[model samples]
Target: MYRWLLLSYPRDYRRKRGAEILETVRDTAVTHRGTRVAANLVRHGLRARLGRPASRTVVLWATVFTLACGLFTASFGTWLTWLGSRPLDHDELAVAVNQLYPDKPVSHIDRDDPPSVFIIYGSPLSWSSASDLLLGDGGEYSLAGLGASFEQLPADSRPRVLAELLQRLRASGWDDTEAVYSNAYDCVPDDPRCDPATIPSNITVYAQRGDDILEVSINDDSTTPKMSLALTRSTPWSAYPVGVVAFVLGALSGWCLFGWASRRLEVRGPLAQGSAKFLFGFAMVMWWAPILLSTSLMLSHHLSEPHPRWHPLWEWLGQPAMSLAFLCGCLALGVAALSHRLPADQTLAHP
Candidate 1:
């Protein structure tokens, strides 16, 4: 059960701190009732989600939670729409390319432009492999003999390492004439195009294989364009399971808080009821605010080419909002506690 509770933490965080947190929980459980232990577990779970100190006042926490909800709703809706519109696989790229180059023969394509002009076309997975070929230690583009992975070389060939190296250069951007016909291996100190130093730090590769015929362009800045592999597109069903779980957990939390509030008011009198209501409200806010803010930040960072300055403000607002929400909640709880201490008639009059 305790291990299950720890699952609420991020994976990296759990790996680093799970043992210590579990130990603390166990000690707390030994000193308190199981119900209290559960409550603490939940409280800590929420604090972790909020990315804030658990000791924060209630009003601040509530405000943060509300803001977070707003951010999350906006961001998630935007992401779902964007993802829906994006190409799912390489087939989409092939279709787009065919439409662009209708007159060109599909085979024996050639271009005289600099080696920097080749386009790379592949799936995301293949693109990752291609990147390793180009940028990994001893990659074709790397300084000679450095960062080499000899395992990448194919079997049954003399000068196998050299052949593998030349193949990468050809795939990267070297023209067929330059790669196969010319003495590409010959070191030329001053030849304008052939000079090793003249070669751009990055190269582009255009692929027209399988279903996709798109270009994977690389730049000196180390950013590579998205690559596509021609494969059947599959729906993102995995995300659906996660979304369902989140919806269920959110619903359960809301329900539990509502029930707790109802009991406090009916059985514990006005003060206790009010306090419980406030605390519950505050807890709800704290629980959701960080989640919403983080979602918004992540979406904005990944999907939109928005200005950098805007991101910090979004992240910054989260902290104060959480603090204010928690503070308000604590005030309400205090008011409820005071009401419980007073006479029933006084409680009724104040309420």
Candidate 2:
């Protein structure tokens, strides 16, 4: 078991002190139970790793590598989270639209409709609310073909652009004006008489309030439901995979630094070695503390109402916390290596 634990130390450490460490472990084992022996072995390894000084070249390179990896991993993870949370595909689009117009009767329009007006709605609250409604809680709807609609728009003509947007909306199931109003009104319950479904299908209404613009469909059977906008322009969040890559690199650097430090510190001494071993034991606690805390926080959040203010910070801390834990483990190993390096004079006094 001691030999196996020694494997956790740097290669130079194992080569230099493996047999002596095992012999000491065996002697210690005779005084304690197997579990305690195992624990002590771990403690010793950590001390050796921490007391050693890292080479300048190794430290510099390791630090650079760690930073690069951490940033890349963090960025990539953030992007993945964003992408995973965003709406996608036809079904996703349908859901988004439905949240925006809950009472609106949505149906796919036949592809034969002529040119028509299109109105795009934009508002941070509206977008957030709709996204939450559609993608967050209600999983029944999705956005599918909007990508194709935007792609097919004419570069030179405003009407063509309008037509394409309208066509995309129609395809996503906004075919009736009354239905649109009814859905909108239903969703916006504060509006007393704004029953979107009750609005006449043939009404040529253009309602603009603040940043919102509502373009009503004129024909009852136009097959595309007209849209109302609270705002006009919107941009999707771009996905970045670099952050995750960075996080991984940071962890690797930490590990290497830990090993280098361990090799340098594991000398033969009594008081010095014992102190290093104790420090290594303490370091182990620090290494795992964040992981335990974060896991507990996550569990607590899942069990209760999510406190919005803390969520972002918690997520941001995740990568760093994990990297730090890994570094701590390495530090512990280094400390253990240091503890094993007892001087000949001190060894006799301590023994």
Candidate 3:
């Protein structure tokens, strides 16, 4: 660990002093002096990286990195929000229907130039709850949603449509097996689309391929002929290798930016103690902790079925946590920058 971490130092410095540092670490192994060594290595590493970076370059890239972090965080947050709200059972059918025909009219509609929340086409059950979360100056034009409706179809065509859907799904890499019927899935409490009036008294068939899930229902709720189908795709983001990329980038860049700012403050006066500076710098990086906590909360919900009451805690903390962390780091930086003056008594000498 010590050796690897030491490699973070400037290449030339490491080349000259790497063996000496390692020998010293071995000599002081029982006392465990490696922490101090690693800390100095990083301090020197920063100096090396900064190797006379112009003020303009520093300010410009700092802004770029900060903006990049914000963009990434926003994107990741949107993705997480969308991922969290993905339709599971009956809701999926509703969303799929809405997307299939968004131009269809509905009631109780809320509209926005780029909407955050709106109900799509249908009577009571068809009005899908949709949010154009991606709309704004830099808005996302796409939507992830669910909607449902009872369409007239002959009883004879029911088997044919289902069989055709099954064949297509199988051809598209879905499992050949179909899900067993369950009366227990009668009505979902949160879904207004599952109002118990539109769904049939007959059996429902569910099929799946990875994250893609398809459901077909035979509803005799209406006096006339009608069939119910709901399709949903719920992606558990944190599980996939690509899914966590945003979270990882958010946390890492946040740490690095905070670290860089705090280091600048530390090196202002006399040669700051390497250990103290590192601790302070690292502590500043923990501002991203709130984001991590929120992410964990979301992941827990995705990974498990339990809806613990404490789940709201995660939502509540999501932004506040990041805010608090950023606030604390800024407060520290402000104080340090304000108090720190140019070094006149001592200078940081080569270790």
- C-alpha TM-scores of all predictions: 0.25, 0.31, 0.35
> lDDT by residue for model 3 over 1-351, one digit each (tens)?
777866555566679988987787667666757577567655555444433343435434344335436534645554555545534444334344454335543321212121222122321112132222212111222233333445555665656756765665566555544433333237777786776654444545555556655555555434455545544453444324333465456644654554455445445544443443444454346444545666777778645432211222223235332444545655654554444456489878998
User: lDDT scores for all predictions?
Assistant: 0.41, 0.44, 0.47
Candidate 2 lDDT by residue in tens digits, 1-351: 567787656666779988987888788788789898787676656445544444344344334434534543554565445344433234444444454445545443222221111111311223444443333332212112131111121223534434544555556444413222122223456688666656433323233222222343323222333332221111122333444454666565565565564454454457664676576556655544544666677778645532212232223334333544545555765556543433456444554
Least accurate 10 contiguous residues by lDDT in model 1:
142-151
Per-residue lDDT, model 1, residue 87, is 40
- The regions of model 2 sitting more than 4 angstroms off are 52-87, 95-102, 105-256, 259-315, 318-351
Candidate order (TM-score): 3, 2, 1
Worst 10 residues of 3 by lDDT: 130-139
After TM-score superposition, the amount by which residue 19's alpha carbon in candidate 2 deviates from its true location, in angstroms, is 0.9
Q: Candidate 3: TM-score?
A: 0.35
Clash count in backbone of candidate 3: 13
lDDT string for model 1 (1-351, tens) is 888877555455679988998898888888789788877776665445434243345435444444444443333433343244324333343444344334433332222221221112321223454444334221122100001011211222324433443465356443322111112135557666676643433222333333222232222322221211121222233435444454455444533333333333555656554556567566555545544675576577645432211222222334322444434554654554343443456444554
